[model samples]
Target: MRRRSFLASSSVLTIAALALPIYPARANEPFTEGQTAVLLRLVKDIFPHDALSDEPYLAVVEQLASAAADPDFLQLLREGMSSLDGAGEGDWIDRIEADRIAALKEMETTPFFITVRVSALFGLYGNPAIWSTFGYEGASYEQGGYLFRGFDDLDWLPEPLS
Candidate 1:
């Protein structure tokens, strides 16, 4: 009985010791509730569902919002959002989306658009099942062709491009 109890206790302690490094406590990082809300709202707006399902979109938004709250991710978002605001005259997402489209047309450039576009792209691309819907084969050569491509052709492009 004593030997059994000793072995059980030692096993428990060993298991716990192994888990400690695998599950270290994350440091507390501050994030404003308002900012988080805005990010969620923006993600939902960018990827709304009609009658299919909301789970995938919601999950993507949650992941993105969590990243947005992180110090490093937040810095990148802030820079992109600030650039969007500076380039146009409205809310951050709207201005950035609009400005990005305009710049893409006028300059025939994609880097500016990519900064904002990639965020939404990532939200969708993160899910392998979602990528499969459009017949993506998951090769580097075929990756670009699988992305959302209708933004460039929106009616607003001509005016902004000119």
Candidate 2:
């Protein structure tokens, strides 16, 4: 096969794998499948990037699941999930997007919200695989900075002086 065809096929397979919904069932994970699903959906709501897939958001859930193995974190996470479920009418996950965002906003000062928000900042943006979605090319200092790269490639911004 030609190199171009091989690369294209590989890209397709990678996206297919990333696009699959995750139901984490690792040994010693503290969360139930239902809780994990809720966490996944919550992560997406927290970071609402339309162009990105669920893989990175699920990574945050998995990370929280692992942390929950510790007794203290486990309690915090359980309470957090419970709070989220109680934040809106019916089940929190089934609520409309606007309602969900309002519920989250109400909890902005809570420990759970702060923890998840901080974790998500790193978990979502730190994933190199999804960097292309935001037009980021990873660290550029090692490559002698963005001066010579596409630093000026953002067409949405006004043109720079020559």
Name the best candidate (by lDDT): 2
Q: Candidate 2's residue-wise lDDT over 53-147, tens digit each?
A: 88878888877776565576678678988998787788888899999899999997776776676556666776788998887788778999978
TM-score of each: 0.37, 0.72
Which residue segments of model 1 deviate by more than 4 Å? 1-55, 92-100, 103-119, 128-162
lDDT of 1 by residue, 35-148 (tens): 444454445445543542555554554554544454655565555444544555665454455454553344223232332233444555555656555655465545465346
- lDDT (Cα atoms) of all candidates against the true structure: 0.45, 0.72
- Model 2 residue 156 CA deviation (Å) reads 9.8
